[model samples]
Target: MTKIVVFDSGLGSLSIIKAIQKISKSEIIYFADQENYPYGKKSQAQLSKIIQNSIMLIEEKFFPDFIVVASNTPSLMLNVTTKKIFDVKPPLQDAKKKSKTKQIGILATKSAINSKGLTQYIKENNFSKKFNILKINGSELVDLVESGKFISNKKYCNKIIKKVLEHRLSQNNIDVVTLSSTHLPFLKSLLKKQYPKINFIDPADIIATKIYLKIKNKQSKKNSLKIFVTGDIKKFQTKLNKIGIKKKVNSLSS
Candidate 1:
């Protein structure tokens, strides 16, 4: 069984890990740098350094066959640098040729949306002309989910859905809404309910598929998973159980 590591800023990456486990047989290791719960607010230099150090640590201990950066902030901030440093590529870069509409809207944290790294990436890739990037701050949804408020707060959930739809509509000709934050997938049903006409793209599926493809050609011993977080273990465990992950959960000191 091949080993794969999934790293996120918080519990949001659980969505991605769930998707991956559904489709693949690989052993998974899930790590949440919850002490730094919001990578979005960090500077590019800070993000780069932290991500490099994290990757180095993961590599040393897990020796994963593939590592998935499942956080949108880190994905956008460190994709290029991580690839260069680790000699690994992200699946988003290799996603199928997008539709000609060239319009892309992102639903991420405010910080990620405001990042110079993302802006430069769009500009450098010439996506500015073909793609119109729109960002929606969905960090609140993360808090809600983590707090176990998603199922109970129907009105609030609807409000968020409405806002996301409105934001997407504001960007004319947007054909794709990038679920930039890992947490956004939990709201997929609500998104479709409010805006069935719009296409919502979750990078997790793409990332998982890419990992599957990479490991397809390699042979390795089977592995299991250990989930670590720098937060309330009982709370984290409850959230994981809510999402159907019953793995052993560990708490890390901040």
Candidate 2:
């Protein structure tokens, strides 16, 4: 079977894992680096070290075919992509195509929003001058999902979503918004309900397709997933249970 490793700071990795399962039969090892939760708040230098260490540790311990850094903050704010390494990035092209007003919003974490890397990424995409790219800080919403509040406390999540995105999206008349953070996808249904007219784009399926295409020829057997966390296993397991992920979460010892 094709062995793959997918990881992020917290529960966000589940979004990518779920998507990958839909299209490919691969053995997956999911690492939740909750010890370094909120990658958004770190400096680029700090995040670079954390991501590099995590990547080295995961590779050393798991020795999977490839590894996925599933967080948008590190993906967009640092030079972390390689042949067998994949990172999640906002689907700006898709947003541009879907947007009638040409004002597309990228809902990502704080560090990603403020990073020069993200700005350069947009520029590299060669979006026309008519296209307006709005970067919104969604760290609070990411926290909601990481803390298990998105599932346990809908009303509160709704409030934070409105507080963080509603005004900015409405003011700019952004017809399309990309859920840039993997954690943000957990709030998609709520976001759609609150902003009915705006089209929310999720990159999970795109990411999944990319991974599936790469490993599909390997002839994997039944799909399987093993989870690990760098933080409290008991607490993280409880959070996972709330989201219906009943798999055993092992402690990352590397």
Candidate 3:
């Protein structure tokens, strides 16, 4: 059995896990490092060490064939041998590949915009020669998704998306709106409602597809899936339930 670890700061990785479940028959052990919630604010050095330490600790107890860093912030900051979604900046690449316009819009957390992985991806891709990228720090969007505030207040969510799309990329003639942050994909519907003309790129889907190709031959659905969280189990469990995940959430900090 292929044992894989899905690591994220909060429930954002659940989006990735859902995609994995549909594609591979690997036993999944998901860990949400709620103790270090909102990884976007942490320094790169701090995030690197934190992620390195977490992986080391996880390896001591459970050995997986590979690890999947599903969150965008940590995925960019950490230099691990794991199979990370943002390793090649797939979101940015997809944005450039699909759009014919000279301008593209990227919505990401504060850390992702500053991370070497993203910065380097942009610098090396010759994106500037082809398209002008307009980046907005959607760190507030990440917080809202983590707290389930968007689901609870749809009106406010719509308002937030409108403000950035209308103001930040108003004159850029954005052909694609890339949700560079994992959490931002959850707001895809709202974003579409506000700006139906622009295409929205979800990195989670690209990541999921890549993972499927990696394990497609060894796939089975009978593998076990476990979820662990560092914060309130009930709240986390509620989220799992809504996502049609019946698995019980165990306390990770204990």
Query: lDDT for every model?
Result: 0.67, 0.91, 0.75
lDDT pick, better of 1 and 3: 3
Q: On residues 1-254, what C-alpha lDDT tens digit does candidate 2 reach at each position?
A: 78889988888888999999999889999999989888989999999999999999988998889899999999998888888999999998888789999999999999999999899999988999998999999999999998888888999999988899878987898999999999988999999999999999999999999998898789477899899899899999999999887989899967
| Candidate 3 residue lDDT tens string, 122-154 | 777676676787777898888778878777888
**TM-score of each predicted structure versus truth:** 0.81, 0.98, 0.89
Measured by TM-score, the strongest candidate is 2
Between candidates 2 and 3, the one scoring higher on lDDT is 2
Clashing pairs in 2: none
Q: How does residue 10 of candidate 1 score in lDDT?
A: 71
Global Cα RMSD, each model: 3.6, 0.8, 2.4
**Candidate 2 local distance difference test against the native:** 0.91
Model 2 segments more than 4 A misplaced? none
**Candidate 1's residue-wise lDDT over 16-97, tens digit each?**
8777776667787788876666776778888888777778878777787677777778766666434322211222342224
Best by lDDT: 2
Which of 1 and 2 is the better model by lDDT?
Answer: 2
